[model samples]
Target: QCTVQLGGSDQWGNITAGTDLVRRVAGGKAFGVVSPLLTNASGTKFGKTEVGNVWLDPELTSPFAFYQFWMNTDDRDVIGFLKCFSLLSQHEIGELEEATRVEPEKRIAQKVLADEVTDRVHGETGLAAARKATQALFGGDISGLNASEISEVFGDVPSSELEKSRLGGDGLQLVELLAESGVASSKGDARRAIEGGGIYLNGERIQDVSQALSIEDAIEGRYLLLRKGKRAYHLVAVCE
Candidate 1:
């Protein structure tokens, strides 16, 4: 007397087969809803990053990282997502549109998009944790986070381990250091990166190629965050 059907766009043929089977065997109309395939701005499949497919589990992505991903969406995608994922009132959405049109840099729409999706996938606590981590990382406020939280926030970045004894010795030159830590390939490459202003340590651009890592610069006594350009991040950890 009743039937349920579930399928993605790719499975439409199979769904029709099921409908045919049902009509012949039980003589009832079959209904179906097909989900469209999702993609990114470049039209690549969604849920994938440079690292790989993004996992839905909180343990895998952390709520903060997930939230940031949504918050960084291109302007073109925001309205479409509002329709697909949000329950916001039409009035609220209209206001968001006005805000976006007036000052896109404020990114009100992107924040709402991120907040809604993060809450749905990871809950409020997860969203909060993610927001906190993002602020600490991007806002240059790393003082309050415990070691575990720091690790969780920077977990996906490229990392290299160094011996604790190495921390006390003469520090490495910027070029040799970056190369030795696997951030760059050679001294020449490191110099090029620095000259181009592509290298940053703890969020500040490093202009001097001769600069070296020192104990005072380390975070929580053992880690350094190195950024290249706008988005490439690498972590250097000193181990005992």
Candidate 2:
């Protein structure tokens, strides 16, 4: 039997009951350690109960998302968060505090906190993936990223699926594809946007309304990136 169980204070009753049962049934000594629950600056407990949780599972929350969650921590709460979440020495944390005061714009404290926690939770590989995605997304040089990486980077962006066969033969016209994918309001709007030098395909400006999207235009032959403006992105995913 385990000697001790640790949990939040709310589990005190349940843990104590288990301890008692073990003591009486097996004549074993067990202990329960319940501590006050930790909450974010907003008073939401850091757990499954909170909608803003930074999940450990890459499937539920990608490493990029996890990294950004910590990086966006409030300046007021970062020091306290570093204290609770990271294994940084107090001296190191003090140095970070000084850095924060000196250069808050650089966000050194939040960066360090996010890096330490993400590295600890996700390991070197996950941290690398997170940083890579972050740089690609921020730098806008996504031509080299595979479809999976693009999907991870734009998980929340609007997306549409296209049949693999559609990119064959005549291929789908850029205007029609944009209209179908909701990147533009209609074929006319798509043409206008293309002519206005606002429509982009895979980050390149599209000036020809007659352009067609083919499998070769897709990253990994599975995804097409459509942009109506600088910041509006739409993903066209091709499937069998």
Of the candidates shown, which would achieve the greatest lDDT relative to the real structure? 2
**Compared with the true structure, what per-residue lDDT tens digits does model 2 show for residues 89-185?**
9999999999988989899999898899889989998888888887766666676677888998987789999999989997989999888888889
Show how many residue pairs clash in every candidate, following the order shown: 1, 0
Per-residue CA lDDT of model 1 for 105-179, tens digit only, reads 999999998889888888888888878888877775556666677777778788888766665777756677688
Instruction: Summing lDDT over every window of 10 consecutive residues in candidate 1, give the lowest-scoring window.
Output: 45-54
Residue 172, model 2: Cα distance from true site in angstroms: 2.2
Residue 223 displacement in candidate 2 (angstroms):
0.7
In order of appearance, the predictions have TM-scores of 0.68, 0.81
lDDT of 2: 0.87
Alpha-carbon local distance difference test for all models: 0.78, 0.87
Please estimate how well model 1 matches the true structure, expressed as its whole-model Cα lDDT. 0.78
